[model samples]
Target chain A: MRVSYYPGCSLEGTAKSYDISVRHVCRSLDIQLEEVPTWACCGSSPALKMNRLLSTALSAHNLALAERQNLSDVVAPCPFCFRRLKSAQEEMARDPALRQKVEQTIESQVNGNLTIHNLLGFLTERVGMKAIGEKIRKPLTGLKLIPYYGCYVVKPPSVTCFDDPANPTSLDEILRAAGGEVLDWDFKSECCGAGLSLSKPEKVCELTGRLVRDAAWRGADAIVVVCQLCQANLDLRQREIGLTDKKEYQLPVIYFTELLGLAFGCASEQLGLDRHFVDPLAVLKRKGLA
Target chain B: MFRLTGALSEQEFLHHVVQRSGQNLLECLQCGKCTGGCPIASEKVSGPRRLIAEILSGMRNEALKNPTWWYCVSCGTCMTRCPVDINMYQVATALCELAQEGGIAPSERDIHLFEELFLKSVEKYGRVKELRTVAAYNVITKNPLKDMDKAVTLMRKGAFSPLEILSGWAKDRKVSRIFALARRTSEGGHE
Candidate 1:
């Protein structure tokens, strides 16, 4: 399987491990990921909030770039990127006036649009749950995880158009297919306070710490997520849990692709397991997968 | 005698918000469901429901300058829960834009400053360079070395990777042109 990939700015920067594991897992699954050619920023909330025209045009430029690629589908690993691109897609589809303006801005006609796919959506639907199950050499038999669908990954159904916005099941379905036990948790779709990480670090710690403690209390081995913002927020803020309260919640935040890599029997180093701020190998060791 | 002093005409204000957010403020039922579902609702920030309800009141100065707009994370919880499908996220964001345009974002000035630095980074390099953006943000916000200690700490924990810093700029410069047009267009072709 092959698809155009837009890794976004985070994957190239702070969330490098996510990209590493995504590549490792995809290689093992025999999936070819051709990157979106020199794609610019997707103009997420900060830019989007400032100017809708700029944000749409910025995203439309990426779509126009994506149109040049031979692939019919473009998969964005970052939830932020996925949402922006999808917003551009929806806006272009919904408004002929905006489409005309965007086309003029980009200096090219948007010949055809690529179907925007999130990481989990692409993995489960396009790759097929059956095929994913087939590639699991070292199935995660004993481990239990909270398949965290952070705010942007699958909410506002009109924009995302995938899964029930209130109670999504794609991640849980994918985890089960890969042989990991899915834990039922209410914070599955809550915000991780990543938006305020810079301006409001304390709030970020408060929210992220709460999710970690809740996941631990509910018997989740680790918090599994697809968004880089969610992973960075929860993973980096594990130590900050002690700042709020006496107890330090040392919950290891695991990216879903890293879990898939482990299930596919890739070695720890190859999947960038050692790079996590709060180590996740302890859980793997406890499960005897180490 | 009513004087138009530092206020948008109701139709013009409504039109600006409607053009940008695409949410019809008239359709809002004023049920305050957005406030009820908001996780960040507090004394400081009332919530989007209040902001939207007041946008049509023609006294947008207070709403525009409120702390609520900056604190919003755009998580879409209110949008998901709204019975009328009001798109509270868009409304809150539009308020932020209006506040920014009017220079009335009284609270959370640092966030707005950082936002400016962030956009400037994108305008220059076509993407946000983490170190560059943060460094420029500090300098521009008059805190040139504000987070140096934190930066050192995050780096020790392998959170700050310098690999991306060295590898700079996208190959395509068409993004620069797009940004140029965006600026000229957004500022009413002032350039």
Candidate 2:
């Protein structure tokens, strides 16, 4: 139940709600999360685009730190970090030349043996739905959600090697076990424009508008997500998206962990549910879960 | 016996892209499978399929200068559906890196600038100070109030503090070293 945790840069800043909710949910689930000490950025998308070696080494440095923790598993709540860390591990394991270069760049020995899991993977594969279901004190019976997998958590099948690339089922299964009605949606694994929001807000708003509109059309109470960027774009940019589209869309973008925490009877504030741009509590209250 | 100009031949251009991306560009069938799944592919931006075609045809300037790659969110949706499993994300990354190194002006300058600023933060602080990066980007891009509304809301929610720039986590020499060493090794240290 104990694993090293890498919260990534976004989790500490723009996605602080995800970090807090993740901690609360893990505590409620009795899953011990030992944060990797002095963890730096996992190099995210910028590193990926700037230099392959930089991106790989950045994640390798964190993995080396994780390896020092003496744990066999590490969980990254941010999908961008998760992908970078896992991709580094995979590339290092497959190519010893790349491994040596990464080790040299990081100035640390990377064993590349530790299992990297995105939050959904940790919850489903490690914690299991059975264990998670047992702790749901306030089941999300009336709450309906479309589980948004986004991109990084499950893509480029060679790197992630987790879940179905086209249609992932882990999030849906977990939500169902938590007693929420999981709506079947085609946009589950769609991209929410991610870091593009920083450079091109219009594109992100356009992409996010599609997701929000579809979720609303499907009659979902909220769009459930595990990735920080997905939550941010889907939640933080609702106003911009609404303004551009000239439609009143007040859909709540809830993190999967927050939903789990609520189901586990954790106080809404403890789960950082109040931090969302679009108020999720209104929808949760309407369902009588708050 | 003729002196040669510096232009890369078609094969050489393709080879560089292949080596840079580490993807099998030669295996691409131009099926447009990648383009079909691409989110940002459009009339102006031909997406992955066209980029790959440009690379195949040795149109180095076109491939590198294309704004399509810059706009790529690295979604990996194209790779998921690619019959040959060509990772357009990596290919776009290689093009961007090549474009920067080769001194070609990026078609999408803001994205390029934003990425540069983003990496500069990581290079300096080991971790990105999100607010600081955003503020710097906004100021540099001449839109100081770009996300003023969201910033105020996020500040109120304690997502990040104005004082985060002064935090202890901003300094990490080891992470800084990683950036320097990686840059060295990536720049043909093997040679």
Best by TM-score: 2
Per-residue lDDT tens digits for candidate 2, residues A1-290, read 89999998888887888999999999988889999998988777888887888998988989999999999999999888888888889888998988988888888898878988988998899888889989989989988899999999998777788899888999999889889999998898988888888788888887888898889889989999989889888887877777877878888888899999899998888888888778888888888888
The DockQ scores of all candidates, in the order shown, are: 0.53, 0.68
Candidate 2 residue A181 C-alpha distance from true site, Å: 1.5
**Model 1, residue A165: what's the lDDT?**
71
Candidate 2 residue pairs in clash (backbone atoms < 3 Å): none
TM-score of every candidate relative to the true structure: 0.92, 0.95
Query: Could you tell me the TM-score of candidate 2?
Result: 0.95
Q: Which stretches of candidate 1 lie over 4 Å from their true place?
A: B1-9, B138-160, B163-172, B189-191
Model 1 lDDT, full chain set: 0.78
lDDT of the candidates, in the order given:
0.78, 0.85
RMSD of each: 3.5, 3.2
lDDT of 2: 0.85
